[model samples]
Target: MKDQHEPKTQSEWQTNLEDIGAKEGFYEALGDQHTALFVERGDTLIVTFENLDHVYERGADRMPWGYDFVTSRGWSMLGLMAHDWTWYRDSEVHDFFDRLRDEGFFERFSNVIFYGASMGAYAAAVFSSAAPGATVICISPQATLDREVASWETRYKKAWRRNYHDRYGYAPDLVADASAVHMFYDPRAPLDAMHVALFRGANIRKYRCRFMGHRIASLWLQLGILKPVIEGCVANTMTQAEFYTLLRRRRENGRFQKEMLQMLQKLDRPKMLARYCTAVLARRRGPNFRKALRAAEEQIARTNK
Candidate 1:
């Protein structure tokens, strides 16, 4: 038999949420589609949105994306989980938020911040309207899936059919009353860039991640800058200069280097590839870099001959 204290399995994670909910704040099933898990800590609250599939994929013991991070700072957390990629478009879910707003739940917190990535980011942005002055930090968030507003969006085909004409429909418009909105996305990602373009207002602050693509959140986590970036945002201390300075940590990241090398290879620039590999190998032992450098040298020699 497994130890009672052993890490909870994927299914058990759901059970665990229920258990925690029974003891602490509350965990309510919004509908057959979504669930809400609230854990109170400090006066500040970090509201996060996540896909249940992604949560379970993280292995047994892992919690929501910002669960550990938020709690570590002694802040409260309200994790909104979607059963699938429904984009959290459910009447029950809307009603739940409406209830929370009516009860002045958000007003209890000294500060409130809505956070997520991708689809979750879209939810975070749209839902921040529930608390007018809340700050929003999202990565690669879609402004809307409404075909009328985002005709060029070919992705999230299922979501295209969902209604974006009602309350909290247009993410960009919903976030207009927010105290601040920070958007992170790679300008290199055509679709992502196009989606972000719909968001306009003085409250919007866009951070370009360049070649980082649509999954800049994961990359920032890998580079060990995710937490600091969030901390800065929460504290209202994040400046463009400070963010870029923290982003420099990517220079030593293997994945970052590999992606850069792949771009060089795609451009057929062996010289730049060689120099990149040499620089990486000089500072650290990278088998991939070493191998690429050899191939680049061979290509250069053949071209010279």
Candidate 2:
């Protein structure tokens, strides 16, 4: 039997909560509302919402790439605080957006991108839809208000329901006007892909990355791999195929090579080395039979030392 007292893993926590009564417990724990803003030099905007029961202070460092991207582009940021997932009353979030609109935040900026991971991703998707031409990129987003509320009830039943009812109103109803929606998910995750599929906005893109585990890992991958794609999409610099080619080439070049070499040295395990060598050789050989065997042998010898 599992240790009842031990801290649960994220998956375990989620599962246990679901098995219990997720909806009832969640709505009872709603707390204070707070928001923070970070302004950059350029005319871009990024709004982030925190997860349930999480304070923004705890998660500020979680998205460095997001901060870096906005600052680098001279954009400004708005970070919302939710005592738990249910902190943002629907009126509050909408009013916040209205305030931004009134201040010409979106109108003045050349580009606006709404981004978040997990619960924050849910907020980004729902809110960005309200902006006329904003682009949204969500990593592992929860697709529905009802599901999220139900799932949280195990730990925060009352707060969850209250939040679902009071703040967001409903998840499906929140995403009616998104300009462009892109979602990334791990295929192995236990949750269904309904949320990602239901985003029938004007422009929608969905990608499944099998290697990265669910949660923040996928977000990190997006930083390294999706940056250019996002920039291209926003700036109209390259088509998706062209952008992907560029990103893949960059990964294959010196940076990825150096990183892989360092990892090999650290692990110092033969099986890993062999796997690495095989992958490298296979990538090089393409469809050629003789070249593959020769390349694999060469890689093995090099790594063996």
Candidate 3:
């Protein structure tokens, strides 16, 4: 496959697609082949493989793109699309990566940081495991397919079983082989918390947060969590201690305060909202923080009236 970055025009893009189809055997077989390039001054490249299930619908914009955060740090971004809620083996995804490897796309880069949140996290963990010495960061990852435990299983029953046979699921087995793995989860989310436990024996690090929710970790991109983690991975100096500190700080420092306040207001829980906002404001003191607290207060006052 040619570098998707080389396609400069409509005709060029079409021709590139045709070439990829020819090389890969069929265009329709490319389950989720969306690629974007961000050029920056750096020797390290971050290849973020997004998870399955409504990726194009929900996560296309959420996953770190546009190089806003990465470019400033002098690192480039490569985003990969997965099989979309369907269970696919690492070989299937690596087939795409192998093509890029053969074309010398990753050769110029010195360090590669593989990141994904949720199911995408599963993909990142699986793909990075195959590489000799690659760093992987997964947030709210599912270690195995437990139908009774996974809330999303009802929506993705076929995909879950298809990926996991009678014995093991993807992340639980693949994580053992990774060079370094960082798994993050919220203790409140039982499924994700259980998923974090599967990486106990390997070079895996675990982080547990309170009330941060499943998607909170991926928001690291927006909340400024990706920078330090990516930098640490590249420099080989990142520790779980530092990673958790960042996670905890982001949560307490007004990252989820607004959303929690909104939820509290909608549920007509003014007292809870006030208490939560008070705690957040106490830790995070600033004009903007106060503004958010006042906004929550206004919502509570309005709802009561």
Which sequence of candidate numbers ranks them by TM-score, best first? 1, 3, 2
Best by lDDT: 1
Candidate number that wins on TM-score, 2 or 3? 3
- Go through the candidates in order and give each one's C-alpha lDDT: 0.87, 0.54, 0.61
Write model 2 residue lDDT over 147-181, tens digit each, in one string: 44345323323345444553345544455555666
Q: What is the C-alpha RMSD of each candidate to the true structure, in Å?
A: 2.2, 12.9, 7.6
Which one is best on TM-score? 1
- The TM-scores of all predictions, comma-separated, are 0.92, 0.57, 0.62
The Cα error of candidate 3 at residue 123, in Å, is 0.5
Worst 10 residues of 3 by lDDT: 24-33
Error of 2 at 152 (Å): 12
Clashes of each: 0, 25, 2
**Candidate 3: stretches off by over 4 Å:** 1-43, 52-78, 87-94, 97-109, 146-155, 165-169, 251-255, 258-305
Quality of model 1 by C-alpha lDDT: 0.87
